[model samples]
Target: MLRVGKKTAEDTQTPNNEIESSVTEWSEKVTSLLWLINADHILPQSYVPEGLENLPNSNVQVVEEAGRAFVRMTQNMDEPLYVANGYISATAQQNLYESKRQQYLEEGYTEERASMVIVDEYFPGGADEHQLGLTFDVCTDAALNLDVDFGLTPQGQWLEEHAWEYGFIFRGAEGAPKIYKPWQLRYVGETHAAIMEKLHLSLDEYLAYLEDKGTSYFSDVGAMHLDLIVYFTDSLSEIPLKIREVSGDNNGHYIVVCYR
Candidate 1:
């Protein structure tokens, strides 16, 4: 267990497997963040990828923006997701193709039954959110962007209320050329999620906040891995972000996000 005090990301640790209150549990992950890097990304060691096969044949749709290729997928199909999933190198595009194929098979799909377009010839990396496999895209209306009424679907609500639980954060919000996607998700894990949700942040605001706080919260050396739970498309949402305090700091300042 880990005990976290308010206002800092530091805590005292307990032996593993010791159960505690919600605060302590979040504190545990916060304090022991050094061990969570492996679970944060799909490369190296994939996180608890239990139901990847069941994720459906996430069509390989590509987009080219500013001279880069980005790989994306369409929406849900008429069937449930399968249970045949695995992870390989991060930069390797083949792993994505294979995962999609397996997912399609699990959905009772055959070659003739393969539906959806495959635009894998080129990819334009949209943003960090895509690299971490956190946020997927959707066609959004430009005029009403960021309007709460526009993003009220169950999935959209999940992105708003629970995406941070999976280490994903909201990015690229609040400006032209960079739109605010309530549907967009990034792998910021628990700390970012908790704080952002509590703060009700958009992508642009969140990044600016991180930089201003001088918190090496993302993609930087000596950065800390915030904790979070990943709920697959078919699974019950994990790690509720219902406002809670995480571990506190002693050696240095901590930016904690509480979760279970």
Candidate 2:
């Protein structure tokens, strides 16, 4: 098992000017990549992920970084990987939400129950991660379907074991509001994904883990022996000037990642 290193307050005495400079230098693009999206943190209808591009040989779109990672992952796989679904537009998500809601209603569920079911089972519009362009559903070329059965396939097994090396995490693996999707992957960057996989933490659990710790350090991540310095705080001034990335935790807080 990979061990997390001891936490330290090494930067506590850093000058205020440095911290402020960090805030100004931090890339907003990096900060937005991992924003948590759920019922409680629903995105606005006008929200759209920037720099979306078509995945190689597929019409499905995702953020440019995510697309590049996805391509690299598939190229390394034995059996070809296929995208079952990718980025969803706000309007399309709303339509899908209505369609599922109506279907549940037709199945004899009350209006209120239908809404609740969809919100829980099928995300409603802006409440979905698909709208973020950082999530994608994958399947093998042999069976182009999305289901739990895919988890048993060679492609799925490969992803489960090695996707973190390429920066993807198995979403909803072990947390609340669980939808139990084995075929879905979300790009949270290589460092974060490595930590999450090593610790067997779901996205929610990972965020909560960092929040509880305030700051954490991990050494020798993967074969690269990379040292990771992670910090969770709402104060922008606390962000280090030389950050690898920053992401919103969907709880009015920010997660800052640095390499040491």
Candidate 3:
């Protein structure tokens, strides 16, 4: 079983303080396009991703790659889908958390109970995926409200089935410790997305699998063969040159997608 919760000190080195070594040189694949942000592996309050682009026909914005994939995904959908929330700032997340907690308290819940309830649905400042600019809450015209039942709707069901094809994943699904958020979609790029879908793994589970295996994972999709190699090391020197792309797992490892 995959362990869930905050990362321990042993799981990852502190941000920006990666251990330097003379073993190898770093590659340019260490970009924001593949950051994995979550409750445990949070982004800093002042951290802002580069190349943020507004989603066409929507007020929300996401990372450039995600925005492009979202546009393509929306175009392929039969029904109209809308982006309800995206690119939340750390301050905004703090406000949202406080507001929800206060609302619960006003409804006669104790302070502790209110806090517990809020944690189930809201992420604290600097610990939310929205800050990464690669996550968005989507909705349909008929169901503008977010609720578990949304998963049963046509639009929601369609997204669950095909979002991965466009590099998106239905985050915080059932069985995961977090609340079921059928409307929330996170972009991790097409390669990782496809591999996760094929393995039927959540982002957390998939990353854990990569870390544990420490070997190249191969998957055959149609006529194309995808190879992914994961490395857990404190120094960039541990990475090999055969790596075509590299992405931080946000927990303490680098995932290298190999190309022929």
Q: Which one is best on TM-score? A: 2
| Predictions: Cα RMSD each | 15.8, 6.7, 10.9
- Residues 1-260 of candidate 2 have per-residue lDDT tens digits of 67467745754567777777678767444456557777777888888888899987778999999999989888898898889788897789889889999999999999999977786677777888888999998877645677777789898888888999998998845312657878889998887888888888888888889999999998888658788888988876756566877887766888888887
- For model 3, residues 1-260, the per-residue Cα lDDT tens digits are 79799999966653333433222334444755556666767788898888888888677878888898898998998988888877988899889889888999999999989978887777888888888898888877534566667678788889888988888887857212567777788888887788888889887788778777776556573125655555644446655445555677665556766653
- List candidate 1 segments past 4 Å from native: 1-129, 138-150, 172-180, 215-260
lDDT of 3: 0.74
Relative to the true structure, candidate 1 reaches a TM of 0.32
lDDT of 1: 0.35
- Please list the residue runs of candidate 3 whose C-alpha ends up more than 4 Å from where it truly belongs after superposition: 1-26, 174-178, 227-236
Question: Model 3 Cα RMSD, Å?
Answer: 10.9
Question: How high is the CA lDDT of each candidate model?
Answer: 0.35, 0.81, 0.74
On lDDT, the stronger of 2 and 3 is 2
The C-alpha TM-scores of every prediction are 0.32, 0.86, 0.81
Winner on lDDT between 1 and 3 is 3
Candidate 3 local Cα displacement, residue 237, angstroms = 3.4
